[model samples]
Target: MAVAIVRNVRPWGGAAADVVIDGTRIREVRPASPAAAGTDGESVDGRGLLALPGFVNAHAHVDKSWWGRPWVPYGGEPTTQGRIAHERAERGPLGLPSVDGATAVLREFLRHGTTATRTHVDVDLGVGLRGIEVVREAVDRLDGAVDVEIVAFPQDGVMRRPGVLDLLDAAAAAGAASIGGLDPAGIDRDPVAQLDGLFAIAERRGVGLDIHLHDRGELGAFQFELIIDRTLRAGLQGRVTISHGFALGELPEPRRLELLDRFAEAGISWATVAPPATAPLPWREMAARGIGIGLGTDGIRDLWSPFGDGDMLGIALGFARLHGARTDGDLTAAVALASAQASPFVHRDLHDLAAGAPADLVLLDAENVPDALVRGPRRALVIAGGRVVARDGDVLL
Candidate 1:
């Protein structure tokens, strides 16, 4: 097997070491031997670079985002239903989000060192599978540069969209990896039926589940508990993820503790974009409870808001600052949540850095992991599956 070495890089801000890559796996990591640095193997001079595992975007709307499109102002109604209508209205005259647009967004993510993602593509009555098709094309185009998990998301209410359930199943058969749901209680208005339909589709399709929960306070808490119950009953413990679980912040201390325990018991995972408008989740507490917590950019510079720069580094910084995490330990934990914590919920091989880990690594121009999280430095190099896919903000492969 051909061998490649990244010499003199500080792995997670530790002492300098050499990472030996054999094909798609990291074969070895050892203290740097300057004398043998250039002896054999294909070498990458990693002096002054901090090597960390590539970021994993646990939740993102790959199809709904207007990343490469001409900047359009947020023209949707403030209400969720109105916004869904507005999104539907635009898809026709504007046409489905193009393959080029989706590819551009993926490239932007690569520039910021995100090597893997779980992208939510809309699968509803309005657009059917057009968005999923184009986004899947983009994902296929960037196959090795970034590994993406396709979530057949129902941006519109699943139960309200009649026949959307079959569409979701078709999306899975066509290539989607997971089934997605939106607001079983708030939007669907039939929590039990919505949960049943979602779980049933997931069961029938033989895929995982990712539900978007924007419902808040008591109702949100109820929906969350119900979903967890279904997950356990379906025996899909670690296979289920709740995105934008804002309800977790609304519960009282005692109730929150109970739910946290339940979440851990059911092996539930939560994905958050750390939006400023909502109550920030007690991330540290949930993490301690052994609940899987992952971070995302939600929607990029899309129609929802004029935020999101496709920078996972910046997102991590925002996460740390949002929670007032100033200590090195706290900041380090935030970084891990944004990157490695996603492994259990997504794919472990793609998000971890170990001897047998996939060669999905980011070399950033930072002295240490904490500094990278705080400063959000530019990526020096990005390697995906042992291939140099990007460098200095440019996509190479």
Candidate 2:
């Protein structure tokens, strides 16, 4: 391990300090006023900049980065809209090639100081997770530049896809971080059975679980209960997650509290994507009650939303715009969902330039943390495993 100190750096917009990077760890962080005596490797004058922990996009779908060419319909929306448009595309014979779609989007994420990202790639009908193969290749190509984890996501109904569970296993074999599935309702209106099978696949294969439940109206807690229950019973409790369970829409106050209490017990992490746009503030209330809310990009550049810029700055802005975190503390919790407090889920020591933590951090141009999200990912610097992978608005890979 070697030492490289950054002087005059403000982490989390606090006072100036020297951040020591020793090997792949943030060795020690201290106030810089006294002019610390020890020096070895190199000293970078981190003047007028904020040092931040790398933004870990707990969720994303990089394959759809260029779905909108201003011509085709959209992606990952309500099936009706897509089906209707599919006919139109079939008739008009228009399509967006997946290979060329995701190029610039990856660069955009790096420029915005996103060092690590976990993306869900679809393995549904007609779509064979081919894009995942491309993503894996791209991630390898961009290996040192950015950290990208691929999840074999069954964007559509899992059971509906022939051999979907098997394919999920294959995705795991291909190094997907977890196995993913969509609403149980769409696959046969039987959320439990399909979810049970999916979780079984996870336990048997020893993989993590990331499920999407946009069908809140129909599935509701019935689906979530299954994920929670299976995760607990299999002793894989904290290894699972539930995404977009928005159907908890304005959950009755009593039920909301009770459900959150149970959710905390189950140790299931919540994924917040498209928060401002989706709504139902009981979510914030739930988080306050000890529920873990991990942030994700959901989809980057899809047809339905057309807005994901692959930069988590947009995710935070979208959240703050809708949620209104009045105080710095409130904003702290909101941003914490993006990283820290994941605890037993992911990135054990994900935030802060804390010692003994993975050296994933950002150098921001913004005045403060919350201000960074609002002001846009500014003058970003990304460091991963103690290596300066990205800077000066360039994608090394």
Candidate 3:
């Protein structure tokens, strides 16, 4: 753990600094000086490289991520409901996405500097927990290369999908990281009962919670309130997340402010995937109010979404475009959303370059992060847990 000076390095900001690392921990960052010392240790030449906290993808579906699927590319040219309908029809019944497909997707993320990701796994009935287990194993196989957090998700209703909750239990027992529920409305005729059951299981298990909200229009009202109450009762707001709560920004102005204010107060964070089609993603308002925000690819290279390239930069760029915000601060905030800070669920200390933090990191081939993200650099060297699992454009290869 002696001094290792990485000189003339471009830290997250554009300013070049002389960074000193004591073993894997970054000891100091200061303006470059002639007297900066480099000791006999691993030397990382930072010239022509950008040093930033490795990117974190707050939300993603790795197993369901498909490439070359029969889906139109993101942003339909027609830009109307009819066009969207036609696009869906063309894609046909979506093929079952698998862990094999996810390998390529994981490499793509690492290749672009996203070293950490929270992936939701499909725990539907017919498939059992095999798909999620497969994904978990793949991520475990990449343990030294990239950080992937798996969520045991019941895409089918927890109550309606007989034995699904039991499957979730088994997943947790089998080392699946978190518990997830999707649209309790899909669970049964009784929405409240379904969600209550799921939350009860989560409460008993002491696992993190991530919920997908598909309630469109008026139906979301009851579902949202119940979710908030359940999270409150669980007393794990710090460990809970709500993905795609799009309707939050769609309510009447006063109502929107009230609920979001509550969301902020509750220690809850929202996962902004498609940027809320109902309203501009509430970026400015949420940050100003201290609400934790994060970004996700949602569905990568799939019929559900063709926008993802397994890159967090793409996720942040989409956020910037959809929200109409631009500034270094905005980019910084966007980066946090893609990092561990984005979710209340993940417990990793992943936002800083420091000693003792796992060497889960990314190196970008650019001058600095803001500009690098703007260029969407493809050259990335990813180190996960002290091993160079991804390098030379074939991260995890």
lDDT for each residue of candidate 1 in 278-351, tens digit (9 for 90 to 100)? 78788878888888888887777665666777787777787787788899888888888877767765567445
Best by TM-score: 1
- Model 3 Cα lDDT, one tens digit per residue, 292-392: 77778777776456666877877777777677657877766666566646534356754565555545556677755567667777655565544455666
Name the runs in model 2 displaced over 4 angstroms: 1-3, 33-41, 67-100, 125-129, 281-284, 342-349
1-397 in candidate 2: lDDT tens per residue? 2237667778878888878778777888888855644334466667658887777677777776554355444544366336424433442233332644555566666777766677777675455667687676666666545567667887556665568777788878776778887777754467776878787778777888888776654256667667767777888766777777886654577766666777778777777775665655565666666666767777655554556666776776676666766677766556655655543344354455777666766787778877876677555556666766676666555
Which pairs in model 1 have colliding backbones? Answer: none
RMSD of each: 2.0, 3.7, 4.7
lDDT score, residue 170, model 3? 79
Q: Give all TM-scores, in the order shown.
A: 0.95, 0.86, 0.83
Q: Candidate 3's C-alpha lDDT?
A: 0.67
Error of 2 at 195 (Å): 0.9
lDDT of 2 at 293: 70
Better of 1 and 3 by TM-score: 1
- The CA lDDT of each predicted structure is 0.82, 0.67, 0.67
Top lDDT hit: 1
